[model samples]
Target: MKMLEGKVALVTGGGQGVGQGIALALAAEGAHVAVAGRTLATLEQTCGQITQRGGRALAVTCDVMDAGDIERCVSEVVDTLGGLNILVNNAQIVPLGRILDVTDEEFGKGLDSGPVATLRLMRACYPHLKGDGAVINLASSAAVRWDASGYGHYAATKEAIRALSRGAACEWGPDGIRVNVIAPHALSPGLRGWMEACPEEAAAFVRSIPLGRVGDCEDDIGRTVAFLVSDHARYLTGATIPLDGGQAYWG
Candidate 1:
């Protein structure tokens, strides 16, 4: 039997990148997935891919910054898939700017999009999550160490997510719910943009990693997420698993 057979998974930011990868991976494991994102077209694309592969999935339009959107998304997941057993908070926005260049508005946007949205989604899914349910928060290697100059805001938000995941695990473990964070260093489509935006710095950043190769989206980070939400990680909780291919270790 598949690892997540008959389970229902709700993944935010499932329209693309790591979120899309995670949604597809979960569906491959026999779980019904709700692909939630602000873009209906992108969400539909992800949903279509799942269904075409003989998996069940639904596209849900959600803006993580909005509480109502999150609540509605969770409700739809339960209503459509029967129950919620896995919740992956993967939606985030990265605004590149130096610390002095970052405005209060931009800082607020980053915070709201990252850790704040993660906390809101967790709270929305808490009541529907059954015993043994899993919550996986998508974090980043930026939280583990400082690399670039303009990513302090982004790193701070991810760090908050890591701490939040640990706190939630400790509080919710008694209820048989596992909460964990995955700090990925994968080559998603966004990687090109990030690299191109700062080529010299990006190259320098890659040189710091021992693996010498950036990770692939689905095979690297997605697999880690899949495993964390499966029975294979039943004994794991409150842990931050680094999928950076030794980047964090070398740093």
Candidate 2:
């Protein structure tokens, strides 16, 4: 039997990058997927790819900054896709600035897009997310390793998400709802753009990693997420899985 044969999933920021990868991975495993993001065009693009591969998909326009939009998108997914079994909170604002330079608004942007949006979606999906329900919150290696600078706000927000995921995992375990976080170091579109702009710096960064290579967005990060939501990981909860090729280790 397929891992996600009768499952439905909503992936935030599913328009591009890691979110698109996770959405596609879930769909390929037989889950009906809803691609949600601020841009309708990109969301449709992701959904198009899924449907083209004979998977069920829906494109939902959702701005994580807006709680109303997040709630509506969750409802839309449940209504349109039958019911939502998995939720991937993969949307975040990456603010590149020093702690001293980042303004209150800059920090707020990360919080609004990360933990706040994730909390809203979790609540919105709670009623319908029963029986093998799972949530995958995206964190970052920057936050885990704590060796990077110029992204203090972004790192803080990601850490906050980890805390939220832990709390949710503890509280919702009784309801059979599993919540976990993923810290991925993948070759996403945004990362590729950064690499192009600072080739030397990017190369140096990659060299610092023990694996000496970044992960593929779909094949690496997305597949890990797929396993987390599958019955294979039914016993897992409140875990922070680093998908960074052994770059960021908690222990």
Q: Per-residue lDDT of 119-225 in model 1, one digit per residue for the tens?
A: 99999899877587999997777654655677788888888998899999999998889999888877777886888899998999789778887877677777778
**Decoy 2 TM-score against native:** 0.96
Task: State, as a TM-score between 0 and 1, how close model 1 is to the true structure.
Answer: 0.93
The segments of candidate 1 whose C-alpha lies over 4 angstroms from its true place after superposition are 146-148, 194-205
Candidate 2 global lDDT: 0.89
How many pairs collide in each candidate, listed in order? 0, 0
Off by over 4 Å in 2: none
TM-score list, all predictions: 0.93, 0.96
